[model samples]
Target chain A: MGKVINGLDIESLSSLLDEARKNKELVQKISKWYARVRWAGTGFTFNSYVRNHSFTISEPSELGGPDKGPNAVEYVISALGACYLTGFILNATKRGVNIKNLEIALEGEIDNILVFLGISNEGHPGYRKVIAKAYVEADCDEKTLKEIWEETVRTSPVGNTLARNVEIVPQLSLIK
Target chain B: MATVVNGIKLEDFNALHEELKRNAEFVSKIHKWNARIRWAGSGFNFTSYVRNHKFTISEPSDIGGADSGPSAHELILTALGACYSTGFIYNATKRNIQIKNFEVAIEGEIDDILVFFGLSDKGHPGYKKIVVKAYVEADADEKTIKEIWEAAVKGSPVGNTLQRGVEIVPQVSLVRK
Candidate 1:
């Protein structure tokens, strides 16, 4: 219903990162809570969302995931879309960009082989590069809207993750 | 490229947990369903392991798609749902406030109109909305369940993002070609 914005008041999200930093206890608890909840490696990060109840998503269909779950790229796009949307609302709340309806369309282009092989020495395999395209309709002028959009992406946590290449530092050393 | 770091805390995690607990509808529906998704970009993952005639998802009666591979949205929803579910379950179990079954359901509408029209835009103008419904089946009765469901939607990561609007940022850098 309402969002609190301060341009760089990401303290709220930082707390989540804190949880990841202190994930030793939580990881074990999480795995025990649900056997399906498995921790693949260290450096735990949280990217949460709701599950789709409609179609059965399995392997080898379209998104390049096996018959088990969604491919990471699609998830990336979702995260981008969701993060962009969150930034939009937060910034709008902060800047008081009234107006009305807003919609976003996001997609990424990826290579097929890299993803399937699970050997992205660079990053994502299938889609070597993915692009997210969003359209906005608001009460402000095109120039204003464009500026706001740029700011949103600049601040988006997920967008920042994709826009920049990140090196993971493992806090916990696994037995393997 | 600009970089931003996010850190979650017990308080934040608990807040998200409470949100999902309140939104019982989304919680229950998602668990019952399964998706067969494929990574179309480059390679295959675990889902492929099973679909390629290798393993099993659940029991033999375990529900699965005859044809493997998931649509784009299906995969998105699964990730979102899984995150929510995992987070919810983790927090809820820690709180010891659970009873029975829980599920999360996400429904999305995407538009390829720009692609169809060959128009250039940062994002798609066609994708209208994606609706998320959470369902909960618990021994706590209906009223408590309702409260929990409400909390979940209000605080859950995915729900909050869906409820909030998305912002777009476009940047250009000069590179020798």
Candidate 2:
């Protein structure tokens, strides 16, 4: 049996990496992800679905919600944190480093929420800054771990998406 | 129970809005949202925490995960959709437009999955484009509803975050197990 680190099959992962390294066509493909949200018939609450998973999203009572689940802004930061962790683990494993533990704490700050509340439109409503702190326990030197982390952030899909501008096409269909 | 519109407490929302307008310091202060993620015991699975809520995150079997929950990319779209929905409902309620039904479908296209797989570094790994389709059934004119939809997309925090550039600061630390 092959060795396992952080519950990852190292032999299998290495094989997959080797295959991709040689197969240009396999690495050139694009992927599409989708999600849907529907109002849950109560106080700023929504049911969101992605693949086979679904979760409730709600605002706090201060925002007039029933506090069913985390708000959308919170979800954004959570997604970023999770994405970073994925990148870190994958890179560390690929580099032959065994990770003992990993955790990412994220904080996202919006420039001005008043724009979202429609009280003021002077400033942008989006997040102006995001800070991610990674706590890692691994079997590698600090230098190697830091390099992996830097590469992970640079190549992270979610990280890049948030750090740069993405084209958004909006379409609306009205049902009378 | 104050009168509800589009599942929102109109009276409460309006009062809060009014308060914010009058309170400059409160509006000027930056609001920070927090989330934490810890590696789960299995393959590519994580436990994500936001406030008091928590959920699982994992990849599909092909990508070395058990498919226990949605991937991080999917969560991004979910966040966008939810944010758009919230913006729409709040705007509609403010405009007194009665909504019978509302849904937001989001599709995001990654430029290349190879970048995420660490297979190739030729192209950007981020989403090249995101398409959002909003379906609304409301007791208002088409023009009005369309305007509200546009406003929602424009005002959505998550939507704007994706459409604009943001700063990301990374801090790394090695911990003793």
Candidate 3:
């Protein structure tokens, strides 16, 4: 794990960024991000630890949870939306576009658990579609901004997973 | 706010398992999730609002912001990992497996922001693959536990997107407010 350092160590990260810019293939820096969740008998909520941070996730009371925190579904939207926004920031910065302000909204629709319940195979239980809108403020004209946005869809990994077609393979490990 | 009332409480969510076993389509319920994020300046940090859950995410100090919270990338993994764990617990409880302890860990590899930096377009900047491990302590044998694990994967919504594929659509707007 990298030290917390003096904030974001943009110097080191940028040096890495510079190296990546020079060596196209060198940019293929492989990284592992981790998240851990433990479920104790606490109102059906899980204490999740991620990158030295801990938070709680619980379903609605209708589902028998204490409703103390956001549900898993809410987190999904947060991830996708934030990922998309990050792309914009990265691109605008690289392009030298000064962003005065920026905001993004993300929404996804998924059937409640029909597939999860194994009762309905007619539609995907996961998000059938995700819609995201990024409201950006920058000095660039709309035409240039649109171009940046287009580039973002291609560059943003999280949004790309949703914007265009990509492949994700999942392997599960079980310990008894 | 729905009163913190107790009704049809599944007593450890086992009620869900029985429902799934009886009728598969019983899962046809639908819900929408929403979030709004804003970035004003410094560190590319973003403040997010979701169902009254307020938080901020900033770039590592290296990049600028105060490192207020985990990067978006970290949150992505957290969402996936937590969702998968939820699936396992739901499945195990449904299977009547008495879980002594339960936990899950998720790890994935994402290409550096070279692509976003306009450095390289040779590869996908997102995760190439996700590896998940569940440490489950239950009264059942390994075989039964394995079965429950499979069941969880088969039903996990987050895992399904990674295992299968889902479409994400994005729209961009320029607004002052």
Ranking by TM-score: 2, 3, 1
Model 1 per-residue lDDT at B3: 22
Q: Give candidate 2's iRMS in Å, 1 decimal.
A: 1.4
For each of the candidates, the C-alpha root-mean-square deviation to the true structure, in angstroms, is: 22.0, 1.9, 5.6
Where model 3 places Cα greater than 4 Å from the true spot, the runs are A1-16, A22-30, A162-176, B1-29, B61-65, B111-113
Compare candidates 2 and 3 on DockQ and give the better one.
2
In terms of lDDT, the poorest run of 10 residues in model 2 chain A is A22-31
lDDT of 3 by residue, A14-128 (tens): 6757765576454443345677888755335788887657888777654556676777767777777777677777666656677787788888777446666555676655777
- Compose the digit string of candidate 2's lDDT tens values, residues B1-177: 688777666777788888778877766543778889999855689999887889998886767778899889888989999999999988898898879898989999988778877777888889989998999988899889988988898899998899898899989999995
Instruction: Indicate whether candidate 1 or candidate 2 has the larger TM-score.
Output: 2
**Best of the two (1, 3) by lDDT:** 3
Relative to the true structure, candidate 1 reaches a TM of 0.35
What candidate 1 gets wrong by more than 4 Å, as runs, is: A1-69, A112-115, A118-126, A169-176, B1-177
Number of the predicted model whose lDDT against the real structure is largest: 2
As a whole number from 0 to 100, the lDDT of residue B164 in candidate 1 is 31
Candidate with maximal DockQ: 2
Higher-scoring candidate on DockQ, 1 or 2: 2
